[model samples]
Target: MAQHETSGFRSFIFSRSGMVLLGFLAVAGYFLWEEHAAHILGYLPLLLILGLCVGMHFFMHGSHGGDHGSHRDEPREDDR
Candidate 1:
């Protein structure tokens, strides 16, 4: 039998910045579609959401806190 070692899967989701850009792209696409169809821009909520995403991306992930290295000192419960 083969011995197992480390467990659990790492998250591969976008690390804040990628998600923000994704939101911006989606909203931009929607706006372009609306403009192409000669319709009113009715997706204001999407714009607000994109703004919030951008803010969070800059504040949460664009600084030293985004680095996962600072959390190394904290002892994990599994260590006990």
Candidate 2:
């Protein structure tokens, strides 16, 4: 006999029961979305603004390497 080692989560996700569970979740999610779509759409603008703010916070600050004054002390090439 041969034995195989696999994590429980990996094994379950590949099993027949896992397929059924995934299908059930898909159906449930579709119905949930259909039911609450109107409410979600009503807040779409607010959600978009919030997402933009969050994205800007991360991306804008990422270039500065978290040091706001690093470039202030350096002399510009045109000044030399």
Candidate 3:
């Protein structure tokens, strides 16, 4: 278990996305340390709006039209 955990950690540290995230956090930490909270806060709404728009775009079209049930809504001719 420890070995697996260590390997996963190593891979995350070496991965491009993970490295970018680490860099982002480091920069954010520096800004926060410099008391640039207001500057960062100014972009909060933009980020939130962008994130929600992206989430809605992906999820809104991801459905496969499966809401219709297996059985037909209309009665069969034999039922007449």
Candidate number with the higher TM-score (1 or 3): 3
> Which consecutive 10 residues in model 1 have the weakest lDDT in total?
5-14
Per-candidate TM vs. native?
Answer: 0.31, 0.53, 0.38
Q: List model 3 lDDT by residue over 1-80, tens digit each.
A: 35435587788988998999999999999878679778778989999999999999889978757765655887889999
Residue lDDT tens for model 1, 1-80: 99774433222225576677779889999889877754335566777899999999888876765558768888999998
Sort by lDDT, best first: what order?
Answer: 2, 3, 1
Report the lDDT tens digits of candidate 2 across residue range 4-57. 899999889889999899999999999999999999999999999999999999
Candidate rank order under TM-score: 2, 3, 1
Write down the worst ten-residue block by lDDT for model 3.
1-10
Clashes of each: 0, 0, 0
Instruction: Give the Cα-based TM-score of candidate 2 against the true structure.
Output: 0.53
